[model samples]
Target: MNQGGNKIGGADSASRAKTRASGGGAPSGGSPALSIVIPAYDEAGNVGPLLEEVRREADALGRSYEIVVVNDGSRDGTDRALDELARGDARIRVIHFAANFGQTAALAAGLEAATGDVIITMDGDRQNDPSEMRRLIEKLDEGYACVSGWRRDRHDDALRSFASRIANRLISKATSLPLHDYGCTLKAYRRDALDPSQLYGEMHRFLPVYVRARGGSVAEIVVRHRPRVVGVSKYGFSRIPRVLADLALVRLLFKYRTRPSHLFAKVAGYLFATGALVGGYGVVRGLGKAPILDMPVLLAAVLGVGSLSLVGIGLCCELVMRNHFYVLGRRPWRIARTVNLPDPAATGMVSDRTAPTKAVQGHAPL
Candidate 1:
């Protein structure tokens, strides 16, 4: 549970070889049919039962599967619990973060470590029912790239539920990806539909939107929700502002990710026009014996300067965006250690599987 170092922890060589033989390692030899990713944060009591339930359900599906759990720097005994579980079950792979990174970072780590044709993501607090996983998988088999779970009857405090409803409505309208429950973590997706590098901040809730923007079809279905019985909820009203900010970021990335200069140019054009109009009015007033250094002329000058500055910023952002897409990439979090997971280098892949492009300057792999 040390948060100061980046250490690599795993099973013995024999266990790893056995895991690779059983399709529990990298996808080089042969990947599992399904990969279930759960992000746990101080969910020491719930992680064990949840994984057991998932194992039972996965066995019922009659397909090879692996469960990837991310220990997001839990202060409790969650990391030790995961280590014990992984020792017994080769299908269970664990990733430990160096510090308490948020849920989005945990999901990014889990998604990158997973090696499966289809990936399922769910909360580790046991609110999402494992028995309903089949429904999501079946829905995915119907030619949809992503299948999201909708909690029609959510079990939570009235205030939190109300806020969630409003937030979901606003997010759906903003992203143009409608879903009854964007906050629900129980979802299934094709491996190709996800780009872990695009995830930052609280963007995990907008995975369906990202998938759809990449030409993938998305679907949603009603799922069962259980009230938390073990640990306290990690979310609160404090996260509302962050969620709103992330929503605005999502909108900007979706609409103007590639050519953001167009959006800036349009705004600058309006500013320039308004400044011209104001300057013309100031000229007209001056001809009528009004003072030349009046408020109108000064306001016009400020607007003109603001417009020019915006244009410059737009050009700078364009260059940065181009560099991000073509040359450099970013990862917002770092991994501390991994258990029962293969090294990407051994599989002929870069260390940071989340980043498709080269890592940005000063963001090297741990």
Candidate 2:
């Protein structure tokens, strides 16, 4: 990002990223020092330039690096252009998704394929600066599982800005990360510190929260923000509603993520009690009726069935959530490899001495 905020991209642009991906190749001797995963959706205008800038920045950091661009089923020439650029830069990798599966899915695919000690994720658009990547990496090196970029003076339309504010509040509340910007794409994560199985949904916005859930600390730094100077935004106001709905679901899941039985039992108990009250009223009304059965009895019957059904559903979901907990714990993720084994710890683009490293890969303490 630049102070002037003229968001444009070209080979000479500082924000240019290089995604030279080759399919599951041999572990490439040792993993690159840092791997950048960028998600692009109809960002042909910006993607080209962002790639170039990432290459230059990585070189300046004095570390081996690889950049992977995940083209989220762009209808533009993004795929072909990335492929063409790959011919010139072996450090760049391109992952082309078959269709638009949203940014979360695109990022998930890139993370699964990445081979690096420290991982960085940013938008393919020129808004997120490659220069700021170092800042995030630096913070990650300070014993933080993830570092998020806070866009100071954002340069988007008012509606987009306002919507993002709402989302950040709700997400911060849920994840308890308390960062100002959850939607900001500029972020860095210690590869082994994040577990993919513990992630899903638009949850990518709350990567820090997910990391914290696994006992990782999250830090934030101010990063410059730039306005869009190319094609229109791919996801517009339509995403606002979806994001709010998803936030509600995330809140519910987080509250009862591990022990859902508590949540289910509470809901069921309340409903069952309410139903009993209705039935008691019905019984009293029936005693005063000319006939034993009446409209009140029908109302009571409907309420009883509805309450029972809700209770049953809640109980069943409780079992399902518990059953899946073990599945998630046992599944393969970025954490198990970095934490459990005797392998070296993860690497970062920046080095700091005060911070504790979560996972080790045999290099000097840096």
Q: Number of the top candidate by TM-score?
A: 1
Which prediction has the highest lDDT against the true structure?
A: 1
In candidate 1, where is summed lDDT lowest over 10 consecutive residues? 2-11
Give a tens-digit lDDT track for model 1, residues 204-225.
Answer: 9988887777667777888889
Q: How many clashes in each structure?
A: 0, 24
Residues 205-293 of candidate 2: C-alpha lDDT, one tens digit per residue? 75666666555566778888988888877758777766665565555555776676786588678767776876677676664574534
Error of 2 at 361 (Å): 18
Q: Model 2, 241: alpha-carbon shift in Å?
A: 3.9
Q: How high is the lDDT of residue 166 in model 2? A: 82
Compute the lDDT of residue 245 as modeled in candidate 1.
68
For model 2 the local lDDT of residue 318 reads: 44
